[model samples]
Target chain A: MKFHWFHLMSYPDLPDDFREKNRSVWVDVDPNLYDPEVGHHAYNEYLDELEYAGQMGFDGICVNEHHQNAYGLMPSPNLMAATLARRTTEPKIVVMGNSVALYNPPTRIAEEFAMLDCLSGGRLVAGFPVGTPMDTIFSYGEPPATLREKYREGVELILRAWQEPEPFAFNGKYTQLRYVNPWPRPLQKPHPPVWIPGGGASVETWRWCGEHNFLYAYLSYFGYEAAVKSMDAYWETMAEMNIDQNPYRAGFLQFVGVADTDAEAEKLYAEPALYFYNRCLHWYPGFTSAAGYMSVESMRKGIKSQVAQAGSALSSIGQVTSTETSWKEIVDKSYVICGSPDTVVERLEDLATRLNVGHLMLLLQFGNMGKELTMQNTHRFATEVMPKLRDKFGDHVDHWWPSSGLANEKTAQPAPINSELGGNSQPTPD
Target chain B: MEELNLPSGRSAKVFTFGDNTAVGDNIKGDNARQDNDNYNDSDNCNDNNLPLVFFHSAGGVDENDPFLNQLAASFKIYAPVAPGFSDLEELDDLVSVSDVALHYDDILEALNIAEFHLAGHSFGGMFAAEYAAHYPKKVKTLSLIAPVGLWNDDYPVLDIFATPPLELGQYLFGDPDSELAQAFSSLASDISGNEEEIVESIIQTVQGLVTAGKYMMPIPDRGLNRRLYRVIAPTLLIWGERDQIVSANYAKDFAKLLRDSKELIVKGGGHMITLEFTDKLVEAITKHAK
Candidate 1:
């Protein structure tokens, strides 16, 4: 299995009465609570943690985008990726990634991702995500009704821009381009590996990902057991579409903490883990699920699933939204797997085997977890735990990983499209 | 109430009154037929009365609403449930406010009504204004209750979509303990065995809001300010005095923009002035319609 270190870069200094006083930690969180002094230290320290993970021999370093949220400070993951590209020699600089729909022309994403690929020597895994409601609908003011269409259109434009050789005139429903020519084509042939990160709320996203042969990375705060149904649904979709069940086509995020012993790990992680769940995720439900964020069909499916979950005994997903969950409850539910190397390895093995996930994105540094503790946790996991699980998925060839060492080879130019005729020069399929 | 089955594969629930006018009988597969039309042969139910068409707010056209029932007694009332506002399949053709306005125009053409009085509440108020602006000759009088098309950065409209279901009463009613508020609260409750009903109701409500968001989300302004002057119909603006959603101050703004208009502020009311002060709304709409 491929392991990657991910950080949310959350602002940990919420006031003592934050839950009582603040309406949310996102969208309209009190700006006064954010101190730039703390930010200066936080950014450097977070970057240091990522670089440390690279030095400790992880497969990749991941960063994501979120806007106007105290839970995540990286509004521009590209900038973070650019910094990582220059700072570290990590095998993969995974930007999982820019919210494609928010950009006006969206060709800007093509240019930026290309730049990152060139800068990182083609080790970039470009992720296009239909961002959370908080990021897209509320923060960016994109109408939820048209968000998916805009996102798909943006992705198409970016892909075509990356591959099409000649400067072409393009007109789309949401975008118009007279000349679509982006300089500095990516170092990777045919472009970098594209992955889509989603919250598993929309079945259409799963189907689209399966049809396109793109990795559908399910990113959720709800742990493995809670996410089984969604993952199974995705694999089922892949099977239906006749896509290979390559484990690399799936990615999952989990909160993890490691220490000398199970008791010590629990004691060390309880405070930060509780703070992460209680304070960082104190988002208003209304803002979280904005109207029209999901399509009508998805909404119906969601209601059905919610009703089913309500009936089940393992209804721990519902508790993630509640403010009253204690540390023990959070740990027991496996929202955060905190234990010694042996205990963590056993639990992770079980989780990985059951879920059949190849890409494991570990959120090592969470809310209020200082750089010292975060590095210590990173070191323990990298040294004692990751080695035991590396050979588990050795039989499968990961088609999703970046062709890193081959970046220096020259890429072939794409065949030109006849723009005047308004059709591809290539033969049409029957 | 009559159900009009349009060729567009969408049906409209319209409460109508007048002579026994059954225009389209060939239309098949409808719950309400020509004989099912709830036409009361009252004294004021004449073509001369000039059919007053009522468009419901974002919540939906509650036919049993006492306010609408009261209005039906005096004038020939025809309130069409806005497409996608109920459990019915949303009309894919009606995408924007302009599309909905044209759809209503088509309804008028189907009914063979040359001119009529138009009134709407909240989101519907915005629609009424847009319709009047688009086809000024079709409407003789326009009434808006807490309309939402115009936006002001200083006094923003409250986000009804983001408000928790239980706290919605606080935003909609001036007195939380009022009968209407209590009724709304009761509807919000999740009672056992009523899960289907509750889920359906929630879906309908969300569907309506989603339809509204096509025009109102991220800001309700759709250049209605520039077009308000085009509405030659005599306009009447009704507002809740204590409205926490759209501030009462916007009434003057609407009055200023409308060429021929006046304002009525219902005392002891909130965003839902139609439900909270039905008598006052009835009085205002009746005075204006006449």
Candidate 2:
């Protein structure tokens, strides 16, 4: 199994006074945490960690963009991708991407992304996110209700700019251009693959992704059990869309902290995990707002409700009670993977087996976690967890672009639709 | 400056002196004012010896806009037909900004100016920025006058000056009636007598906005900052100090990020500084060319 490690690279220098009072920077962390000097250092260190992940045999390294927030400092992930382009060889550089609607003339996105793709010699996976209400409204000044429509327009324009070999004209309700052409075309044929990273059912989004043959990654911040439900919903939608249920095509993101032993890893990860749950999620409540973005189906549905709908618009904020989650609770629910090499492997294996997830995204740099601890976790993961997982999964995939050698086929998991369980079972039986 | 009604059914008004070099004339004459009928638009410039192409302000009356005329004299300017504004055949077939780019490219090729400097004022400036980014190689320089593309949350708001300045300003900025107000305003500012004749001129030229306005494209999201690196040519970003539509800070920031670029803020002017400070603008253009 090819593992992907994504570091949010959060710069954690909350003001001394703010932290002393134990004020929640959790969901809406202190924006002041991003000091330019400290940010510069932390960003470089994060780049090192990503490059290290690549060097350590991870298949891909992921970086994303966020604006005017302290939870994540990368306002332009392409800047980081460009740096990585020069810093490392191999490993696909995934820019979870610029929010489409947030971009004025989406062609600019097309051009810059093309430049990075060419610069990287074709190792680019372009991600287009509809964006959260906070980014679309507060950050970009976009009308909330129009976010999805604007996103659609932006995507249509950008794709045309990239794919159309000949010059073209694009006129939309919001953007009008006489010429839609881009230079420094991507190295990949017909442009790099497009992936949409979203949260919740987003049934329409998943079906569209499946129809378009793009990868769908559910941004799982709520942990493994929740992730299983999201992935399950995606698979069901894929089947409904009459698309093939390819396990490798499905991916999940998790916050992972590993060390020499389970006890050590757990103790070290406790504060960071709590910090993420309390600060990152609590501080950014704007991610969940009554923006007209929610589809009719989503408007009526409750959290964990069975009605499949397009991207979840409202967060069931009051669902989870209490401000803090203990390490014991995290361990019991397997919401996170914090343990020794053996323990990490066991937890991941369980998740992969349960969800039949083809791609695993490990978020190692998160919360107020410092650079030192991040590197330590990376080293341990590279040396320990990766090897054992590879051994169990047998790394024999048809395409291994960046790294070398072939994965052994013996460790491959059975197809989700196979008759191994029962020939007469429901096609997408959970 | 020379004005000639060509024998080939085309009229030419050429300006040359300080920083301007341009030749242009209105197409519909003084009868098509407020004429809702769309006309076919086309332009041809063959300034083989010229190194610059500049587009003048709203009226298409190149001679009267002294600031733009002065800039034209300092540089090789080609303020050609802006579709319906000039005598060229107009088409209602236009739909997108990219389409305008394609058509504009034809104009450039027809001009025999393979690669040249480019500058525009007010609405025209917005076109220059987009054109430069699209055809970076064909452009050697870019000059804008109170350009309207960047509208950040903190964008400066321009104060209107006419008797009904606010209403006039709204029209000038984007109202369909902007053409009528622009013509009357331009002629009234230049000469006082014969309001009837001036009104006629306004009507004939006012309709030009339909095509002229086509050149302005919606500014992209963080587009200016990201595309700065893509433009390889030296750039000159200009804005009027008294101009209210776009802030000087925008120009300052744009200048800072635009590699090999310079900002010139003209004093004693508003968004219409392209008309108010023609002399100084021409001087700045001439200096930058050197």
Candidate 3:
């Protein structure tokens, strides 16, 4: 199994009363709460961690986009990918990815992704996310009814721009271009492998991914147990579409932490995990789904399911917005897998075996986790846990990984310790 | 009530009542007793009342609504279901509010009616105002009950799209404990454990909201302020005194913009004025439409 190190890059210094006092941590988050001075350090530190993960022999390093939210500091993942292209020799720099519908002329994304692929020597995993309601409908103000159509059109435009081989005039409902061509075509022939990160609710998205032979990454805050139904649904759709049951076609993100022993790992990870699940995810219920965001068919299918009914009940009563799951509850739900290397491997292997996912995107750096603890977590997991699971899915060809020859090169080296930075050296508080 | 297939693959459900057999014979006789209670029984009446076009609220089309039935007693009523409100896939064909307004014009043309009295409630009122402003000559008389076309920054309309089902009643009615409010609120309730019934209910509610969102999501104003002055027909603006959705304060703004308009505020009514005070609405609509 291939492991990708992912980071949400959340703002770590939320006030103590943020959950009680703030309306939400996204969309309309108070701008005064963001400290650029702190952000300067956070950005550098987060980038250093990604480079460190690349050096630690992780197969891929990923960054994603979110707007007007303290939960994720990267509103422009492309900028981070560009910087990573120059700063690190990471085999796969996945910008998972630009919200295509938000761009007026989506060929701009094709141009930028091409430039990044060229800069990275053809090592790019292009992710096209439909984006969350907060990002697309609320922040960007794209009409909910037409968001999916616009996204589909934008994807078509971007793909054609990258591969059409000749400059062409293109006319689309949402976008129109007199000359539809991007200079400096992608280094990879016919563009980079496309991956779609989704919440797994929309049946159309599942069918789209299956029909196009794209990897469907089930990006969920809810853990593997909660993700079973969606993953099963995707596989069922794939079966009906007559697509191969290659496990590499699926990717799953899970929050993880590791240490020398179970007790020590719990001590090191509990606070940050709680902060992530409780404070960072404190979004308003009303902002969850915009009207007409989901198609009428999808809404009908979703509302009939028992899970959706429960979710609606919770959302209607504001339980999802106000309730903060305790650290114990988070662990019980497996929202985070924290323990010794052996314990972590056992749980992850169980998850991988159950879900049959070939790509595991591990979120190592989460809410308010200090640099030292994050590095410790990353180092231990890469050194101990990853080796045990690397050969589990060895027989399956990973068509989803970067085709750039550099992916197989060995780059395992310990990250340099920065003792001068007090926060980077601080020991995890028990 | 009859279903008429329209152009552009659209369809409308219309309810008609007046007798067309005596159209020219008793035209003047009907004009004389316009104020008499007996004139309401159009079957035995000598009145030559113009066809009344009733538009349903944003919630969805209800051809059998009590207020509409009451109005039907006086004149032939045509309540056409708006696109998107019904579970029709043709909703994708409707791109804008103007498209919806023009479609209604087509419906009128298809029905072979040149001019008529038009009345709409809430979201329907917004569509009616848009229709009147676009084809002023076709609308002989206009009645709007707690419409949502005009928006005020000081007294902004409530975001009903975002409101929870249980709490939506507070914004829609003066006394949510009342029988009518309970009935209106019941439409949103998930009373059945049966998945199919629950799914159907959600689909019904969501489709209506999606239809409404085509014209009023993000913000309710669709530049009606600029078009209201173009409507040359005499207008009547009615408001529920306790309306929480679009505040009753907007009644004055509508009265000011309309060419020859009058305002009436029903004391105990809410945003669902037609549902709560059907008698008062029927009375006001009858007086103004005449």
Per-residue alpha-carbon lDDT of model 3 for A1-430, expressed as tens digits? 9999998899988888898888888888889999999999999999999989999998889999999999999989999998888777755898899899998899889999998888888779999998888888778777677789889999989989988868999888789899987987887877799999998778999899987788999998878999988888888888999898888999999999887666776788888888887789988766667667787766666655543556443232222444788877777888888888888899999888888899999999889999998998899999999999989888899888777633554433334457455536767799
The CAPRI quality class of candidate 1 comes to acceptable
Superposition error at A105 for model 3 (Å): 2.0
Residue A44 displacement (Å), model 1: 0.7
DockQ of 2: 0.01
lDDT of 1 by residue, A180-252 (tens): 9998788787888899999876789988988777888889886888888888888887889898888889999
lDDT of 2 at A247: 62
Return the TM-score for each candidate structure: 0.89, 0.53, 0.89
| Cα lDDT, model 3, residue B127 | 92
Please tell me which predicted candidate would have the highest DockQ against the true structure.
1
Question: Candidate 2 overall Cα lDDT vs. reference?
Answer: 0.61
Give each prediction's DockQ, rounded to 2 decimals.
0.34, 0.01, 0.30
lDDT of 2 by residue, A1-430 (tens): 7678887766566543453454434334455554689877877778888998888878789988777666677778889998887776668888887788877788889988888776776778788888764455445555433457678788878878888879998878779998887896776666687878887656777776776777777777767786776677778777777766666666678878887777777678887776765555544333343223444334334433311221221132111222456677776776677777787888888887777666788898777777788888888887888877774445434222322211331212234555687656667856
Q: Over the stretch B1-290, how does candidate 2's per-residue lDDT look in tens digits?
A: 54444333334444433434332322211222233342222123222224566655544645555664455444555665444454323423334444444555666554445566677765556556667767877776677666555556666433211112113443343222345446644533443445444333433433343244333322322244555555666777777665555666678666765667877776545555554555677777766654
Q: Model 1: number of clashes? A: 0
Candidate 3, B1-290: lDDT as tens digits: 67778876778766655554233323333353554766667665433457788888877765457787787767677787877766646566677788889888888777776667889989999999999999997787899989998889999999765565556777788887898778766655544566676666566666777778767877888899999999988899999999999999999999889889999999988998888888888888888876
